[model samples]
Target: MAVINNDSSVFQRIPNELANSIFDFLPNRDIKNLRLICRYLDRHVPLRFNRVFISANPLDVKVFLAIANHDTFRKQVKELIWDATLQSPRSCGNDSDDDYGSDEDSSDDNDYQGQSRFQRGCREAIEDAESRLVDKADGNEQQSLLDNLMTSGRALSYYERLVEEQADVLETRADEEAV
Candidate 1:
């Protein structure tokens, strides 16, 4: 019969390679929290999160910039997954066109049209609020906001071009990898 000592840490018992293998299965948030636990974990956890997500949000961009500025953290980054649709729910304003239905009942048609118009109004209101916020921002704040916006726009454009050129090959590779 084999006896195991409970006094010593389980992590200490496990080999470093095995520990790293386990860490690879953890979510990014869990790995980040684990990094805060100890110096050893801090050294390893950042490397596990190689792919960083940069969204259209200002805070996400700031986080990306911080990571980029750090020498150790920057070296750990392997890929950046940019989410351009973070700000708006729908990428385009074609929801109204999709809502059109061939209904004989006038009331039903009226209701559909009313709902479509309401959605459009809501979208416009959001855009207006965003523009107002930008306009009311101070010089430095406005410039920062503009910089973030430009960065997001550039990323989106780059992604679009990549998709246009290599979408089929990328999709096939992704599908093959998934299988």
Candidate 2:
């Protein structure tokens, strides 16, 4: 025997407007998670993520291409913005130490001229901290500060690689090709 239902399921019964309103209030992450949880919700709440960002980063361009190529996501893209700013050739200020830091040593130029402004600042700060440590810190505090500064320096190096990659991308007009 076949059973006939007079009433439809709650999801099929819900209005699109109400679903849109609910989705509008939810964050992007939440919307994605919600869709994954319930197929009914996924089908009912069509993604309204209309805006996207593109930058010098390779992953950024790759993702943009993926979206543009996609049948559904392509329709949602409303804007394609280019991030022009690139972190190229860090300036080691030779003009005045006052601009970089007030430390007395900064006033006297030396081999440290090769260091970036931020690197100089970190070095000055660490030196100042070491002096304050007095007898309490022999090499222990200095080593800790050195470790932290080294980590920061490593991060800066990674960023520099990205900057170089961005410059290459623009030179080859890879962005135009992707489009």
**Once model 2 is optimally superposed onto the true structure by TM-score, how far is the C-alpha of residue 35 displaced, in angstroms?**
3.7
lDDT of 2 by residue, 29-90 (tens): 88777666666767666665477767766777898888888898889778777776666655
The backbone clash count of each candidate, in order, is 0, 0
| Candidate 2, RMSD to the unseen true structure | 11.4
Top candidate on TM-score is 2
The lDDT of model 2 is 0.66
Which pairs of residues clash in candidate 2, taking residues 3 or more apart in a chain or in different chains? none
Best by lDDT: 2
TM-score of the candidate numbered 1? 0.36
Q: lDDT of each structure?
A: 0.53, 0.66
**TM-scores of the candidates in the order shown:** 0.36, 0.55
Residue lDDT tens for model 1, 1-179: 22333335356678988997898788888777765665556654565448777654444555777787888888888898865452222245644565544323333111222334333453445446567776464666655654344232344455555454344434444322321
